[model samples]
Target: MSIPDTASMPMFLRAEDFSFSDEFSDLVEFSFLPGRDDMVPWVEYSGGLPPKSLWGDSICGENTITIQSDMYDFLDMGALSFVPSDETLLKILETAEHNRKCPLDDRITLGDDIPEFNTELCEYTLTIARSITETIFTRDPYTGIVQEHSPPYPDIPRFKLTANPWMVSTHAYGAAFCHRIHLPLVQRVGASIESGTLPTVFKPVFKPASFRRNNVPTLTCGTSGSDVA
Candidate 1:
């Protein structure tokens, strides 16, 4: 699962957008279908590497939630460079402006206000946008790969991109942060995957003894508009 261009791109939506490192040391869990456990693609993706992931658990509403993330913020450079038809260029510019600069300062408190993220969210958007451009123009993975099933995506790469644990962590952390902020972070993620990056699997950390499972789940397109608000 190579990294996609969406890993670094700018994105904004009405209510839109959107790792791990602890498991390698002592704690361990083995399963036949680790995909059900939801922690494989990321594990394998980060093997023999430093922590590109982040994790935490908190009470959201009533259920205790456990979060382990290995995803990324891909950019959509093509979209940026894309010169829309004259009929809709103005709308594109307007939408870009709105997303790039969200005016609502009314902060929502997640478990607590994450100070670092407060300043970094805007900055990350810019970086994520760049990821899209760079991944698309520079990598060119999807250009050569064959999508046997006639997949919806056109330019996604054939395999994993370089390790950027922060890529996955950024989105995951953002969602968690959204939880604190009382924003629809989860919804934002869905929008992003549709509009920004690819679907991520819960990758396995360790090479399997018998077989390889395409587990780590990437983001997916659901019944939601693609964008992060």
Candidate 2:
């Protein structure tokens, strides 16, 4: 079945809008539908399924399939850009700070005498923020075409420490990253259909996959309002 016109266009594009190599194209197919023992040709040809770090497990059902992936993974794969929002960065920072002070007895701790602010963590945060905000990506949601805006993000502060962690509950990095992976899959599936290679038994139906993020409340116990002493 043909994809609907509205959803036909891909939602991701390469940096400078360049084309992906034939090898990469082949990799994408194998990457798709991972862990399907029934279809092992692609995996067998490619020296086994890719590591979980690069690709996520495939979620399959009677009618639909969902693939999960990390933003950095795609970026490593030559994705033009993958920057988590300022909010996500802040939350990550907050969680890191909170967890540093409140380490679980079971899990390993960085050290007993943690500094007021972790120098390495702070430096890492700044580096990631710079990488993301350095290039403002104004992406077309439907076409996946990315237009680079100079001067980066002007309004949103690169990073901010929220006094009240409770005020922040929502996380968007997963959803954003989900789209990053979704667009490519859509593009490839569409190509398969056009090439008359898509399985005849399967019907083409695309649905908006749901992405979930864990809040600090779930990860740590006790009051997140103040540091544990």
TM-scores, each model vs. reference? 0.17, 0.23
Tens digits of lDDT, candidate 2, 13-76: 2222212221112111112223222222221112111122112223212101111222334433
Quality of model 2 by C-alpha lDDT: 0.26
Candidate 1 lDDT by residue in tens digits, 62-122: 1111111221211111111111122222222233233323422321211123332121231
Weakest ten-residue segment in model 2 by summed lDDT: 162-171
Off by over 4 Å in 1: 1-113, 118-165, 168-205, 209-227
Best candidate (score: lDDT):
2
TM-score, model 1 to reference: 0.17
lDDT score, residue 217, model 2?
A: 18
In candidate 2, stretches whose alpha carbon ends up further than 4 angstroms from where it belongs are 1-24, 28-81, 105-229
User: What value of lDDT does candidate 1 attain over all alpha carbons?
Assistant: 0.23
